[model samples]
Target: MLQSTTGIERLVLVPSLLRSLLMYLQLQKRKDALACLKLWVCSGETLVVSLAKEFYNYFPENEYKLCNFYGSTEIMGDVTYHVITGMDQLRHQDKVPIGLPIDNTIIYILDSNYRPVKTGEIGELFAAGQNVAAGYVNGRDPEKFVENSLAIDPMFAKLYRTGDFAKLEKGTIFYEGRTDSQIKIRGHRVDLAEIEKAVTSIDGIGKAIVLCYQPGEINQALLAFVLTETNITEHQIEEALRQKLTSYMVPQVIILDSIPLLVNGKIDRQSLLKAYGNVNNNDISFQNGIDYKGVPKDQMHAAIALFETIASVLGKAARSTISIDANFYNIGGNSLNSIFTITALSDRGYHINISDFITAKDLGHILSKLSNDRKNAYLSGQTEHDYTSELLKDEYKEDVLDMITTSFYEKADLEQWLMPNIYVEDYRELIDAIWEPLVDKRLSLVVRAKNGEIHGVALNFDARDEPEVEIKSQLNIVFEFLESIEGPVRDNILPPGKGTVLHSFMMATRSTLTPGENVSIMNFMEDEVLKLAIERQFAGIFTTNTSPLTQQLGSDVYAYETIHDCQVNLYVASDNTKPFAKAPDSQRAKVQWKPV
Candidate 1:
């Protein structure tokens, strides 16, 4: 209808609409339709320099002009205008300038205090002119339309706070981004537009949009969606961003074949956020979004269960979709949350050791290690010895303390790092400090022989509710190292609140028993601990294994998963020295968990 009308010399549209129309015309070979238009006015959104070049290529710079109009409805449509007469205007520009004020409109780039910022300094764009709306309906948001503090004329007395940020350079205003787009991330004030610019500048990325998910929350994340022209992986984009942006400013990149757009041609940001939430949160509608490509037919059931469980635990905080090739850490799984994933998987009748999950290169690697069979055939006939596991009683307290002290001081691999600096008295003081709570919680277990001799002890506490004890001994170094590894896991990943996790703090066995006998006794004690967790309605058992024997049993024999492993010698104390420097490189402290 518009093409048939006479004297149609000018066209006005949003930048998105113009781009869409131009693409359609090029696709249909209908460049003649644009011939009637002498000029095109693009507004509402920032005009890409590339898009402007494309326009002139089709319409011919000699015949038509492209003008960028910048304004909002509250400012009576447009307050500033910039015209591009040829490709030369866009050659050296990073962004198309919003240009100078139109007619009687006055534009001011002001700081937070409403004072004019120096030229070239980015600030909020405030406008004062006859074009500015008097006020909103019912005086809503009266503060947005304030008195023009620097105005000397009646026409410029009222300034409309555009809420947009821009900078004036050499008599021209350049659009920056919305004021709300600037946010604090990990103590750094980040500009989302700046990140977006950096992303789009990378080769093969056609366009990019960056958005923050769950802003200001503990699990808050910045996500980047890129429309790419090549087979670029998300990891590659993230790595590129790390080089150009600050570490915290780097976002989880999600590559798209095509950027989703609304009917009016604007980027569908809400839809993008919703789709991300659905996939990450394990919403039933999007469960198929998980890729099971590398999974075997036999493991399909386990894969589905594991992937869905991981999604449920990670929820919207997950940075990427659950996929067979996705690394747990890259997809938002951490040591603490790995326990939550293990527990969730266990609930579904599938189990894997935390070590196996942690060490697995990808979800497919984890799937190969996943076991649906809960029966421990190897351990079936091993319990022939006459050892019974029971709760620790005050009668056995002195024996338990002695056993713990002797085992840790003489045989513990982790303490070997500190060796002579650590004392037997240190273990006694530590045992004394935790003795009260261990007795009260009733979670600790002890293995006793038929002759009433206590052979093993497993000190347990509620993971979320463990009491804070102050240690004056050098043993505090070990405790600090433990906290450095365990604190983040507990606070960030595990289910919040108490009663969900039973922390198997310290486990020790008497040196009197042979290695095989020690394994059997520890196995029995672990089973009893699992039973106790079930009886107490706790979700799982959390523990760290510094001894090779316990670490082996936790993963190979008792089915506890290893979530994280830290090299003993890598531990640096507050004194800025490697306290465990003498420890072998192979010696590691493995954080393990067993789901009830």
Candidate 2:
């Protein structure tokens, strides 16, 4: 074996030694046994992360790689293995996607009843390839690997199942855990890897291993063994995790060490748990009205209650025990819901940046390495580097005022501002589409144009996630953008300023705004079209802030509440590079045209 910095390399060097051994062995005349070096398994969610590390470390620095093996096990012996880069980005996140479909491979994931769930939903992965193994050995459970009805149509060939759970997002199949590894908590099957992922996301801990600990006595609680640096303290470790993990997924005990694996190369779950007793056993509680009570939790069950509360938020089964520092994120609280948790905490008189959980939740071990305080904090979340080039306080009070003033579009000539440039036929079509719907309602969009051309457009409707056409898909972004641009208008949409719940599945916009003209157009939309939607009884309005119609109106006519990215399936360019536009289409971008 050769020595190395990253880890041991070339554990089996079969060259010069084989030359000498040739003298003793009869098989020396023959080369080594023929073995196909094809990728046998693409690491699935059922596969542990340690296996990935092993494969990576086993090969030479530039030689090791991730390959995609395609085709069903029934047809062929794992027909294809396509290698690719960009796996480093996903190494610490979810499953690594090797790439697209390979030659002669039909990979599909199916449900228990063997029906396709959806285009991108999670299912049991099955392969159909030329070299897949014909069948399993020695009375193996047939149903687990067999499909009676031959799923892929037209081909009609019987396919063997891989039994791996996976989901497709944006056309990329992502592996989930095996159904066997999945644990049901409160009617939801939980992926244990997801919990482990959250635990590892905590900074300062080098390695984290979670074990299902049930001593055949009390309820099941997770036991986490962490490998970290020497300076980490127990207290800091507990707190660091609190930011990222919810309650139930947190381990009952955390054992810290410099190394996590045993000599046999397997995780030493037993050794870590044995060492956990020595660390500080004091429980930290967030009891109401107690104000940082230093008293131990042995006398009070408040900490356990809080733990249960956090677990409920994460939808985890009520665990028997949990560590105080467990991060909420790793336990299935995504960035979106983590923000909700922060809101909940804020209402309880504590403001926390979920990022602080990185260091603060380090079980007192890694908290010392933190450069900044990871406690009660309030932030707008939009990074300074993201927009204004600096992270600010919870509110950007001064700049917000200036932004509002600059964003205003005053349109004293309302009708001319409504429709800037449009042909009469198209304007009439748009009018007919809205005018009929409004006949049953109170108000309607009155279309107008210079020569009967449609200048701009506006509409109103009750919110819903139905009908996959038009602008319903962008309802979230449009609403958030409107809220950020106009608060009073947003409030006007919500009856009694409360209890109006909504998610948009439809919305549409036809715009000529170039990338350079986007900001200007936003000001106009906030000032004009959106205002018209609210005046006409829209619960929320969505239109660019700088449309010709909006520019005609002044800034004071708009007020917003919040604005953020609406994550969706689309190829949104990283750079705001405007698509090429013909001259006729380019004129539509000018802020002077009004919508009829």
1-596 per-residue lDDT for model 2 (tens digits): 11123423222211122222323332333322111221233421123343344344332334444454433335544443435333353367445543455666667677756767797687887765554454678857675445436545534354667656777677666666555555432112346667666766565555566666432111234555665534675446656766666443455335553434465444555766554423332333211111213324452343434343444433321222234444333333332233333344444433433334222332122122212222424232212211111112213322322222222211111112222122224323333344433334322222222243222222333332112233222222323333443334334443443212122111112122221122222333333444454454445543323332222222212333323222122212234332211112212211111121
Give the C-alpha miss distance for residue 38 in model 2, angstroms. 16
Q: Give residue 109's error in model 2 in angstroms.
A: 1.1
TM-score of 1: 0.52
Candidate number with greatest lDDT: 1
Write one digit per residue (lDDT tens) for candidate 1, span 465-512. Answer: 888899998788888999989888777867678999888888777765
Structural similarity to truth (TM-score) of each candidate: 0.52, 0.35
Candidate 1 steric clashes: 4
Local distance difference test, candidate 2 = 0.38
What are the lDDT figures for the candidates, one per model?
A: 0.78, 0.38
Clashing pairs for model 1 are: 353-561, 354-561, 354-562, 355-562
- By TM-score, the best candidate is 1
